[model samples]
Target chain A: AQSVAQPEDQVNVAEGNPLTVKCTYSVSGNPYLFWYVQYPNRGLQFLLKYITGDNLVKGSYGFEAEFNKSQTSFHLKKPSALVSDSALYFCAVRDRYYGNNRLAFGKGNQVVVIP
Target chain B: DAGITQSPRYKITETGRQVTLMCHQTWSHSYMFWYRQDLGHGLRLIYYSAAADITDKGEVPDGYVVSRSKTENFPLTLESATRSQTSVYFCASSESSVETQYFGPGTRLLVL
Candidate 1:
């Protein structure tokens, strides 16, 4: 079985400061990881994904994530945070070698960007 | 307009009522998925369809039924609504099993 863990319940960061959200995973084989953001009363929007190439992958709205094979972690990052970036973020993972196509999602981290 | 859509956006029903949530996409994606989101659990897949008429169960599927008669539409039905079944339901579609999935606006259901 594949699973993802986002240890933090809430992440607070000041505007213009670097922000990070941690995620760790347990899967049978290589993993396909993804990050999504949800605004109030809105559906989740895809942020970024890490499939097979470089460890650092850039995504929408100036967000990026680093995939560390040694750490078994994929953490989302932003160089500078904005107040508008405050929202609920989720990390999901799927086994690459497994054909089930089911993704295991973390409980989610609520980001609060303070101005 | 041109993306995935779910209806009705908000619904209120009583226990034991049967309700159906509709999803439609225009991308012609081959895979469709239904997920329920709650406070602690981010999102739990109820069912997924690889193509028209091809469906499978996911993490949580006991209380829901899904059907895809056409490529653009997938509807989830709750045979007997329960208070525990109240959640925000989201419909998503991807070009294939490995592709990025696009989600709909979601339907908020309340069962009293």
Candidate 2:
């Protein structure tokens, strides 16, 4: 079975400061990872994904994530945080070898960007 | 108007009642998914449909039922509502299984 773990419940960062949300995964084979953001009373929006290429993947709204194969971690990052960026973030993973195309999601991390 | 949409954005129902959530996508994607979001659990897939008349169970499918009669419509039905079934339900669609999924605004259901 494939699973994802977001170790932090919430991440607090100041405006204009670098921000990071950590994620780790356990899968039978290689993994397909993705990040999504959800605003209040809104559905999730896709941010980025890591498939098979470079370790560093860039995504929407100036967000990026690094896929470290050795550590089995895919952490979302932003060079500068904005107050509007405060929202709930989720990390999901699917096992590549599995043909079902089912994704296992983490509990989510609430991001609070302080101004 | 051009994206996925879910009907009855908010609903409140009593236990033992039957509730049906409707989802429609204008993109005509081949894959549709139903997920429930709670406080601690980010999102758990209740069911998914690959194409018209082709549906399957996901991580959590015990109390939910899904049907896809057409390419654009995928509705989830709860035969008997329970308090534990109360959550925000999101419907998503993808061009294919490996493609990025687009989600609807979500329907918030309260089972009392």
Candidate 3:
């Protein structure tokens, strides 16, 4: 049972506004989404992916992500929010019946780019 | 890039003792991973490798034990420690196998 869902534990944006961090996935075939960012204790800092062509995918720093294969979802966007872009946000998935490229994380979402 | 490195960063042992967690990567990336970060239960794959002898088992490989012979090291041994294996251990690298995944600077275990 491949899974990844970050129903949001916290999100508050207001630096330049325009941010969204929400991801949804459950795969069995065709899914490779990823977006990570963590800062309080360091580690994790790759911010974008959605393997298999555009549905809007751009990465690093000024992140971007949006791959919604009919609501299976993959959302993590930022038009201009910064305060160093808050922290803690993860949503990952990689599965195809799990052959071992291992990855299925999500239960983290805490962004507070307040000003 | 002096990427990935996870050592004693912080540790405290007790419960049944016997622990070893050290991962080093200088971008020899052939894929190597071992994760465990508890808080809200995220990042939880417990072993992986794709070079140097190869290894695999993820989504929590109970009691953990891994090795990669060589390819920038990959060590994770626990054999007996448990207290839910007090977590925070993370070591990652990638050059393939789905790409971009490079983290390290995590190794905070405490089981007493």
- Which candidate leads the pack in DockQ? 2
Best by lDDT: 1
The sequence of per-residue lDDT tens digits that candidate 1 reaches over residues B1-111 is 349999999999999999999999999999999999999988999999999999999999998999999999999999999999999999999998888888999999999
Q: Write the per-residue lDDT of candidate 3 for residues A1-115, one digit (tens) a residue.
A: 7788898799998999899998999887888888989899888888888888779998888788889888999889889898988989999888755636778889799899989
TM-score of chain B alone in model 2: 0.98
lDDT-based ranking, best first? 1, 2, 3
Q: Report the C-alpha lDDT of model 3 over B1-112, residue by residue, as the tens digit.
A: 2588888889999998899999999978999999999988888889899887799888789888898999999999998998999988989999988887889979889999
All candidates in order of TM-score, best leading: 1, 2, 3
lDDT of candidate 1 over A1-115, digit per residue (tens): 8999999999999999999999999999999999999999998899999989999999999999999999999999999999999999999999998849887889999999999
Where does candidate 3 clash, by residue pair?
none
> Which stretches in model 2 have alpha-carbon errors above 4 Å?
none
lDDT of each: 0.95, 0.94, 0.88
In candidate 2, position A68 carries an lDDT of: 97
Chain B TM-scores per candidate, in order, are 0.98, 0.98, 0.32
DockQ of each: 0.81, 0.86, 0.32
Candidate 2 lDDT, A8-99, residue by residue in tens: 99999999999999999999999999999999999999999999999999999999999999999999999999999999999999888874
Clash pairs (backbone) in predicted model 2: none
Q: What is the lDDT of residue B9 in candidate 2?
A: 98
Choose 1 or 3, whichever is better by DockQ.
1
Model 2 Cα displacement at A46 (Å)? 0.5
What TM-score would you give candidate 2 relative to the actual structure? 0.98
The ten-residue window of minimal lDDT in model 2 chain A covers A95-104
